[model samples]
Target: MSKISNFFKGGSSSSKSKHHRSRGTPSPQEAIHKLRETEEMLTKKQDYLEKRIEQELATAKKHGTKNKRAALAALKRKKRLEQQLTQIDGTLSTIEFQREALENSHTNTEVMKNMGYAAKAMKQVHENMDIDKIEDMMQDITEQQDVAQEISEAISRPFGETYDEDELMAELEELEQEALDEGMMSMGGLPSVPSGNLPSLRPGQRATTRRKVEEDDDMRMLASWGT
Candidate 1:
């Protein structure tokens, strides 16, 4: 375990960290790259240890009773390798968590910066505008619209001719009354009907109609004229 730690964070690591401190800090991208490299290295070590454990287990199985000492040694080595692999897994997990947090923080920082820039741009644009001026422009447009509507109404209305609706309706009623009187005079000039009491007859009608009597009289007059 100590050897693995020393291999990753040797004397050169201390010098590199000091240089980074002097040069400001490492970017999240660079940090993530280093973490991924470490993860890869640890994963390869895990594979090697797994293979050695399998070989040790095989050796233990093969020498069940005959070569117990050698088999025990192999199993002890395998146990140590397993413990180292477990520690590496824990370290890798910690590194991955830190890398992810740094990545998220970096993304948030860029987003905030872009939002700040947009806000500044909006402020600059609005600096040239006035709310009072906008209201005045809207008022002018409304007055123009009213003037246009008045002009349109004037163009569509008649120029010189205007009639009083009450007077026209009264004249029309007088013409209608004159027509009704003419119809009544024509009807009254017709011969008056014999309004005397009628002869006794059935409920629905007389035995011979008044039209039939007139027809008989006309026939007798024609015969007398021939004679």
Candidate 2:
């Protein structure tokens, strides 16, 4: 019975010694590793929160919400989620803002492309400008003006008669010739020709011959000798 009690006591003390030995102090490296692991976990949570906040901001900007209040209100019960994310910012009311650039870089490119397309579409329209119709209208107006001129010319002249260009020129030439002939006739009287005959002498002629005998002695001697 004594041996059994001693054996039971030794067993208890050994178990207590084993427990004490198992509770040995941790190394500095182990404590540092645990601290780093906790820090990494916290860093991961911060990163997740930051990404979520950025996503929310992007959504708000895309919809063009009026104000933060409106955006917060739009979150509804999700506001709790946002609060959880922003709560760790520690006493600072300021928020981080990163501007998002416009995604549509080529603004005028669309307008220019459409303009080119419209120009190509209108090519046929520009080519078919109804030039023949315009020309026909112009010809009609010219013909009407010519008819009006003809009517005016007819009214200015004698009625029921029309003169052609050649006929008018001929008539003018004839009138001019007639005026020249009339002018010449008024300048000089008519011309006459002489007849081929001589007139006979009378008593005045015989007296003239007798006065010729008294005119010269040569003439009277020639007359008595009769040669």
Candidate 3:
């Protein structure tokens, strides 16, 4: 019974160790490095095998029509080498495919990680923002701007000049009447000429005589009117 218990304990410990090891798998970069090493080894082997195949082919040709048995042996060796080269080619192709797949997977993982970070940043940016609050803020800003514009227009308006329409019209009519009276007085002060005496007067004296005669006639007419 003691021995059985000890065995079971050992088995459990071993299983736990194995689980830990399984969890600690090689990273993708390490795996790709190992795959590339393998690819290089296979490529070298393929080159060697191809060289061997060529050597055998040359040997076979050299022995042809001379020694049938020797030529047949060389051809058989070439065929075997070619087979090995084909297997190496297949192995290299598999290794390259695995390496490329690992690289693509690594790139995709990084891309997904960056996208997750971006999503987190965007979430943080929107965390404190409420749609209703934003709308209210915008409305307040618009109202303030409208008030400022009204104030600015008020400040810019013309100031201090005012007049009554009736007063201005009356003053304009008074000035026009004064101008007309002055014009009529100026016309009345000008001299007049006598009708029949104007032809007998000398040209130089006509203007002077005309003025004197006009004054005399005005005075006579005034005296007769008084009588």
Candidate 4:
């Protein structure tokens, strides 16, 4: 009796130690994976139970009225399998809800962690920066841009153009008059020679004819002007 009691105490202590040394809690990702696997297993089991229920139902119908005992037994088995299928359905629903919750929580955790990391990096980047220096840099850039724009406008401006408009117009008119005079001297108020042939007239006769034509032209011009 003493040995048996000691053995029982030893077994209890060993079981307690085992329970205490159980595995740590799984991460969200692992938990979700485990839940999905369990769901799959339960789903397969549900399918098997459904198949068995159908088989039992068929057996019961086939044995109806001919073997009442066998039919009753088949029906009883089908009912039990149906109940098991129902239980599995409920379990699957619970596991699915839990998995979804865990997945959402994990996503939120990762997002928050990344956001915190980015914020830290940004803080570090600006840790040594001065707002006053930043403002001064911006102001200097604006001033340089203004100076550059002024220089560009100065370079593009027209130069060496201080002549008076009235004087330029008078000079232009004088030049035009000189050109007209040169043109008139070149013409010498002579009639154009005929391209086909010259007139076959005596020299003094031609000179006399020309003087008479000129007088007639002058008289016609005076008449037109008076009209």
Point out where model 4 deviates above 4 Å. 1-22, 158-161, 174-227
Write one digit per residue (lDDT tens) for candidate 1, span 1-227.
99988987787788998987899977878888898898899889989989988998899888877898988888898899889889988998998898899889989999999999999999999999999999999999999999999999989998887999999999999999999889979898787678998678874465457668889999999999999
Candidate 4 residue-wise lDDT, 1-227, digit = tens? 99999999999999987886785567898889999899999989988998999999999999999999999999999999989999999999999999999999999999999999999999999999999999999999999999999999999988986789999999999999999989878999677666897668999999999999999999999999999
Off by over 4 Å in 2: 1-24, 65-70, 73-227
Alpha-carbon runs more than 4 Å astray in model 3:
1-23, 162-227
Q: Whose lDDT is higher: candidate 3's or candidate 4's?
A: 4
Ranking by TM-score: 1, 4, 3, 2
lDDT by residue (tens digit), candidate 3, 62-179: 9997999999999999999988988888888888888999999999999999999999999999998999999999999999999999999999988998799999999999999999
lDDT of 1 at 70: 85
Which has the greatest lDDT? 4
Q: For model 3, what is the alpha-carbon lDDT of residue 221?
A: 100
Compute each candidate's TM-score over C-alphas: 0.69, 0.23, 0.61, 0.69
Clashing pairs in 3: none
RMSD of candidates 1 onward, in order? 8.4, 29.7, 8.3, 8.8
Residue 111 lDDT in candidate 2: 72
Local distance difference test values of all predictions, in order: 0.89, 0.67, 0.92, 0.94
* Residue 4 miss distance in model 3 (angstroms): 21
